[model samples]
Target: MGPTREQFIQYAPAALAVAAAAAGPWSAIAAGAAGAGAWAISVSAPALRSLIACGITATGCGIAAHQVLASGMNPLFALGLAVPAGAAALAHHRNLAGELLPALPATTTAAAGAGQSSQAQVITAYWMEFISGPTQTEGRKLIQAGAVLAHLGLDVGDEHMSFTGIITLPQGQQVRVKPADIASVYGIPASQVEMGDPKHYAPNALPVTVHLRKAPEQPQIAAGIPTTVEELWAAHVAIPDGAMPGTALTLTRYDGPLDWEGIATRERKAIGAVNLQDLAGNLDLSSIQIALAPTDKPSQMGVRVMKEHALMHGTMLSDVVDELAMDSRGYVRLGTYIDANAALVPLAQPGSGARHLYLVGGSRSGKSGILEQILLSAHKSRIAVILASPQAGTIAGAGLAAHCGDGLDEAMGALRLAYAVMLDREARYRTPRFPFTDPLIEFILDEAHMLLLASSQYHLEAKAIVEQLTRRSLKRGIGVVLATQTPLAEDLGNSTVIRSQLLIGGGAVFLRCAKGQGSLVGTNAVEGAEGIDLSMIPPQWPGQYAKIADRDMSGLDTEAAARPEDGTFGLGYLLTPGSQAVQFRSLHLDVAPVSLAGSLPPVAVEDCEAWRHREAIMRTPMVDQRGKNLIGSLADLLTKAEQGPPSAAQQGQPAGPQQAQAHPASSAGSAGGDARELLKPRILELLRSGSSPMTAETIARKLGTSVKHVRPRLSELKGRDEVINENTLWRAA
Candidate 1:
């Protein structure tokens, strides 16, 4: 049941008694149950009950103050009551005024053929539009006096004039005028303006458009027209010298809810394929501001544009190369090349000519990605791949011809086997009439500089073997690709081999690198290809490379790199003999997740038959005739050395596998020590000495052991937390 006056009186006796004591009975009832007080009394809900309680309390206080005043008590009591009552009355009047104001009338959109005189009628008619009742009367007065045009400074122009000022509204709310908002008042498009702190307006005068419209002459009616109309109109038209009055004015509805989705769609299309920075002057943030109410302005908002960079997607290898799409033999698809036309170009034939490839890039620079692509494509082509990496069988372990497991000895062995193959090829080359039949032999080395470092004991031998292979391997259908983080001459023993390999045919694939370092590679490899601006190489463009081919060798003109400059990492340049570098992205196998070297399809026995044929000859068993001959010769030499005085009789004979193998007992002891006991103490010593973390190679060198031997122990130590492996270098835990 709804609350009643009698029920309210029963519940609030004190409030009733106080009110009755100060005023008469009728006055008491009216004061206690009128407006909010009456509404609160009639409601039955808990919230309404609470409001009633507060009203009763306030009423009682008012009654008590009235009684005190009548009794001639201190004036402070009257003042106390007056302050709160006055505030409430003023707030109520303000709210009432806002509610009574009528909204602006909806009108037809202005037509292009609408005469210039119609502009004035449109503006005058717009004066009748009011979002609030209280503002309506004021708007009428302003219009009658012609002060609306004057206040807006109408000049009727193609461009908006701007102004900045703080104005106190009739309701006493101070609003900071925005230049863009002022331009809208004159029916012109606005430029962007910074709306700083809400508390303070900008000091500089803002620019805004002030458009004017000529109206028909009419007799002034006393009730409708004000005395200031002529004066205001005259003041509105006064223009500064040399400033032409703006004509071509268009009226756009100013106060309404914004269409955000439409704005976003339009902007996205306007931006096109250009970068976000390209929209500097063309698009203004204010034009797209979301204003829900008439008073809500762009001055009270902030804007942020989410930008997206050009990230090309992966292209398929088969799609890019015709050979791969067909027979796909003897070609390892690296990546698609981004050609001068910005088209997908494929690298069909790798290791073209004897000049091997040098894949130079920094850590995580998509170097590994490129390597993986090469290996997978090479396998598809039935090319024999020999991998010498720190990790064994990284992408596909079992199908590989050989995996140099994380062992320095194993790595050296792989290279030695390659050298042996080179020797065999040289011998076969002696027969002039031999059939030109042989699978292309690829010696792919990962982290090759470790073996060529000056600190490495076998640097001289390794360098000699690589140089010899680079010079003669191509004719023998052999190719070598060396990938390293550092491809500098110092790291490679000297520039002689690297230079020859690069200049051989297709130049190097230079990934993200320092200007000086990349330039060094270009100049050394491609003649006149110097001063390559590394800045043009996007830092974030992973796997993107600057490839200079034979065509670009003579002249430093790489203007034909590719449009949009950057492409998918697998897309790159392929420089081969007799043709310009083609831009293409590598074809990826249609799998759940494409891997460069890893996750390859199983290698069929038939597919690897060529590799098997070559490997059998290279890996001759020790029990065979060749192995037996070496063993007999080795045994005889050892016996003679033992019988002799054991003086140092080995000057040119560098320490090699054959020499070590001759003395079986000594070799076993040395190998066992290196692989097990000897490396442990050396590692502990290095850590205890407070030396910086060292890589396996550095530790091996210090301990006179192979890197292969130290890595396993390092792994064990790392697991035990006795040592820490930071990016491959080890330190005390």
Candidate 2:
């Protein structure tokens, strides 16, 4: 039961004494005690008890001081007594049930250490929090922590309790907690934690780092850089003491400490032991920019180190660079230095003038599109184009239709004629004594495989002609652009020819084939391996190409810089000489029909009638050589009869009663039973000629016989293997 006022008053003295002991002042204690009693009443009545607590505390202190002076007590002792007494009174007034709690102890602050020792301490703390929090919010906090850790390169070991530490929280506050605690508190798995330093983890712990380390940095490929097989060998031998020639390196921590001798040796070998100066002259490095390493990971070491030297300046280790290169241009461009003394020099324009280019890619892989762009560029240059497509309608309606030819022979002939025409024009105005400029004529063959197919002899001839033209035609300003779906070097006859003419490659097979020959641009020029889809290509972007050549610099660049969304260089751009640059565009041509070698002749009306009458006679069934002879003789008789040898009422043609009544029989002496057989031979003989289809009446007139007699014979002849009547046309089968 609740205590009454009198019962509360009865305990007041005891409460005051306790308060005096705790607070240190008798008067203060008394005041606090009184306030507690009043507070209890106020709990039952409100305003009165609330006012009593304040009044007693103030009044008791003053009264206690006065009592101390009057009673001659120590003032310090009085004040000390009042302190605890006041605290006790307040507690009672507030209706606190338990004993008053003690003041907080001072806490020690220290800096957290690092390494294994600190790790252990942090781990223990992590466990405690992990086991304590088991709600959704805590779990979310854990995930955030893990994310931060990953970003910082930290590897939170597999133990759920391993990430316990003070994490930097929002508003610059630090919360010392375990990852598992945050996970448990937030109700999520530790994996979801997206907080912490990613770099804190060892190299082995990060897949990206591991992959970066394994990836090799390709050597700098420079246009017009003299290099040879011997130099490549020297470069390899000159590799730095600690690194292998082909080992991966990054630019993060590398200084120019490469083994120059080794690198020179390798360079020599790569160029087939050619003279170093000569090799350098043939390697072009224009359009390439060297980038410094951004990170210090071991995986990046190869790229970083190589980037430090002038020799290794163009070498890069990132796939992004390669991707940017390819995506920037519609095709991969390779820079090759031309050697004046080289036999293949004549195949291309002298000193990087204009070069004939061949492009290869598989079906639906943008071969045609790339070719179209190339042709368009040439056209802009005012180069005359001669195009051919055996698949007639396939590329019709495309701007290229003007260049398409009928068949392989016709195509080759057209090219030859164009050449001859150019020659004639050149000869008329320009001789060795007098030079005149003329528009260049470029022959572009789309679907080149049609001309290279094994079944066509014309394909072989075309190949020979193309080879000869490519080898010698550049002097005459004649260029050829041959595009095909196949990249087989043997199919094109000579590997040297393909290498000499190949300017671009797209699609998987074409790239693979090019790579096999070490002809493709480096991986550094392409987007990362994951950037491109392996299965199918996307819709054609007007100028998109796997690689492109820098005509002026004679260097290859992977992709263009222009953004596709703006309709600039959507696919990529090919920079020509001077101020000229062309964006690639795809051709929208219709499918064409296959070309046939010969044409068919037309039929005449007279031939039609003669064939029909002959077929009619042949449809009848008849036998007997003598009867056949009679029918044969009937053809001469009908011709004369038609010419009016005898009139219908003439004496010789008089209708005899017996002649009209009885069927005609052969003089060869077969009676009525065999007589029906006579008509069969004549009809069979006529039908065997496969002349024409005819009715019984027509056959009877041709055979000089009655229709009634010929109809049965024609049926008999049909039953035998003598003839066939199809669509009313009688012919020998």
Candidate 3:
């Protein structure tokens, strides 16, 4: 098919000679000689064809230059000879067909649209083959392909490449079909067809790809297997020990049942439960150890399903009052007991002794919640409540008989009034002619320790108030609830006599604390309060107490005080009279605005008017002669019974050495008169700064004094015409 190497060698020299002759005879002869040598080298060593060609061109030029110089001709003419030699060598080269073989036409190009259609046809064929097979192997491969494509932001579509196709069951055979037939092929009515991705999908839907949802299998719970509680319940597996029924359980890889992780409540039941539709069946659970759910850890028992209640969650304090038909004049409702079904359980009796209650808890431990509950319940029962606190703002909007400021004088004033009421009741009880018909008055003192243990002149008065209230208030139908954070004996100061009264006939709730103050509530507060694990308490359950003194106790000995109990903080225990302790969750109330802007919000409206009327009558002084004489006599007796000598102010004389030393208030004022004067200026500054008149309470708070003490000074300033007392507010004159 081609010329041989020898043929190229033979033609090379003669061709070069003829070409060189055009330049000159000397060039022709010199080129011919060069061509001859090139042919010899190429013929002997075929691999050196390129080298020989180059060498020959250079040799020819050299020889031609010599020949031209001898003949006086140009050397450039010799270059033309090398061109002919190169042509002859190329003519014999036979590898051209090999070089052109790769370029031969193997296929033809189509138009852009036709080419796209062809590609789509191939892809469709491949995808159809993957999904249409009866075996799961092909189906799995198809699913895998879909997953891969989906991850790449693309999905397998129908013939039109719009909606994705569905693998459906037709005539009991698994078949890959387009989405259009999904409604009809599955016997679904056309009118009932839903939008894309409905709950009822094609038989072989995409949801089946997940391992848990692959197919229904024989249910088995294995320990340490990490199965869901829904799976265990669905299988009807026997609940392991240390776990309660109606609770969700998960199986680990080992053989024990653990609480399902992330499952806060147990709403899922067996197949026929009414709430089956709403069960969260997909959560993974862990193994639990005790019958009771632990609070600290992720225990499934932490959740309680809420059941519908008929009235006020059926556990409002007012409900208890109605059920017992308690006499409003002598009874006030406390909190109700909640049963397992979330139904309210009526207490043993309506007015469980109507004794005083001692509420103790740490910060944010639902103390205020309980207090609000008591106050609102009393209001609903048509009983008046008298609230006292250091911060008047704390009860600023509370609708009550009276709200006493935290100041010692105000607190003393309220106490004195309560003692007077107690005396009136005592006199009535003693007298056969008069019938006692006053509605129960509840005196709630918040932060009692601060009031009783003050290092000021009012401390003795505070002590007196406590002793008198404890001894006579109960008989007078005056209920008292003293609340504090630290209930230590030392905190109670000289008023420790109240502790015995609190233990004898009162109720106490000792919330979660590191250690129990045994002397405070006596042994009844935390008796048999053992086996409580503090490790189980969580931060969110702050009001959890270890023990609660129920209204009635049958087997308990009132004489034996409870031991100093220690347990996790905030886990509450309910101790009923004669019954075993019941663990309970703290009551959660609706959030009320902690502000004092507009109308006071009342708790319940049904019986509020009756309660308001009764409270109004009691606060009004009696106009009858007997009432006036009794009130005057009592005031005289109280005023004359004072043991300590009057201070210099009472005597209307400058403080003598003994008088100054006797009265702590006078001593403090003498020691810090400059500081007291500073407070006056600060008070004036606040009054001048405000656009509106400021209440005495607000000015007292700014000056860090009790409103009772500040009101007298404010009066002095008013008398001097430096300020004006408008309503209950003070403003610059």
Best by TM-score: 1
CA deviation > 4 Å runs, candidate 3: 1-353, 431-435, 454-457, 494-496, 512-525, 528-537, 541-571, 574-581, 591-636, 641-645, 648-733
lDDT of 2 by residue, 491-534 (tens): 46433454354332111112112223322223311111211111
In candidate 3, what are the lDDT values of residues 659-679, reduced to their tens digit?
545544433444565545545
Which portions of model 2 show Cα errors greater than 4 Å?
A: 1-354, 393-402, 406-410, 422-436, 493-733
CA lDDT of each prediction against the hidden true structure: 0.43, 0.37, 0.42
lDDT-better candidate, 1 vs 2: 1
Clashing pairs counted in every model = 41, 185, 33
Question: Which candidate has the top score in lDDT?
Answer: 1
Model 2 scores a C-alpha lDDT of: 0.37
* TM per prediction: 0.37, 0.31, 0.36
TM-score of 1: 0.37
